[model samples]
Target: MSDARPAREPGRRRLVLWRHGQTSWNVERRFQGKTDIPLDETGVAQAERAARLLAGLRPTALLASPLRRAADTAQALADITGLPVRYDRDLIERDGGAWEGLTSREIRERYPAEHAAWQPPGGETSAQVAKRVGSALERALDELAPTGQLVVASHGAALRLGMSHILGLPEETWERLGGLSNCCWSVITEMRDGGWRLAEHNAGTLPEPVLSDDRPDAGT
Candidate 1:
């Protein structure tokens, strides 16, 4: 297997959407939406390891959610790369409202209809999150240099929704993008046509080139 990172085309920028390390709530499978939870011991270790690898990418800028779990995770990379972490409120996780502290099973039992729709009563809707988080990402990109790399440390749901928004994927098709595991990341690269392409998702290691039918040499 090649250990190379994804190939970057000229005039293209890159964004690494990284999820925060795990917390106690993550282990318990509790809804931690917008909660200010800190990283657990294991989470701290995970962040440190991931940071070492990310630092090697030499990111140009680091941005993160204001929540402690995400801030701390970003700090790990900051410590290694000497990059200042800029916190953005819009990058915060989805607000779970009445389902904030409930386990998945509990939410299913208590609010079956809402759970089926994956909406939390009184919480921000998926559209709200996608727009908010997506706008934040765009603002950050505006500040980046052409061909620069940005690493955004955020929550799982927030990153996924924001990515879908950036790629112009409709809400109904957002589910086609899978969730990122704790401390994993997804990479998006700018296209020559001014759009974005997902290079990698839910990945721990650096990305390698993808082989697909779309490639010119596919049948070779």
Candidate 2:
């Protein structure tokens, strides 16, 4: 979900991962996954802006999560990049298990400590979610024969955990990067050392966090 399909040429690969535009569920601040909601008007505008922003990237393959929000964003990016859309389930948001359609406030108010939905059990914690996401992205890379430019449309919650995972941030950092805006992007680069590194991390997302590299804690 985080990585793109391979490009036609090899040597160095560049993958641009963009979180998808907003949905009605997103706008209303609800949990989404298998929710199958469409983007709102503002979300459409956001996709258009994202399309223009990525228009000149010349990506060879436009990949997206199977979810409608992500698929829709990928379509717009495809139109701009002149590439067809490819769907990957790994790109999908965490199952969210029993909390697919509830808000955090609702969950806390309703289920409280008894909430199994608070943290996924045998499902995906932030680390597990990112592992699968990174793995799914790697699979996408392998599928594109001979390599090609790639773009992926993802979601904010997953992206938050993913960014944390890629940057080696702590689990407590989850809330810090959780509330990303629609169609925003946070880039990461594959370092020469083979460890993927954060590049312009959270460049086009929300809620500013003044960083302190000295204390790489959950400050985001």
**lDDT against the true structure, each candidate:** 0.83, 0.63
Q: What lDDT tens digits, residue by residue, belong to model 1 across residues 107-184?
A: 889998988778889888889999999989988887788879999999878888899999999888887776777788
Which lDDT value does model 1 have at 203? 85
lDDT (tens digit, per residue) of candidate 2 on 60-104: 777788888888988887777677898878777776666667664
Model 1 whole-model lDDT (C-alpha atoms): 0.83
**Predicted structure with the largest TM-score when compared to the true one:** 1
The CA root-mean-square deviation of candidate 2, after full C-alpha superposition on the true structure, stands at 6.4
Distance from true location, Cα of 162 in model 2, Å = 3.4
The lDDT, on a scale of 0 to 1, for candidate 2 is 0.63
Question: Which consecutive 10 residues in model 1 have the weakest lDDT in total?
Answer: 211-220
Using Cα atoms with residue i matched to residue i, what is each candidate's TM-score against the true structure? 0.88, 0.76
Clashing pairs for model 1 are none
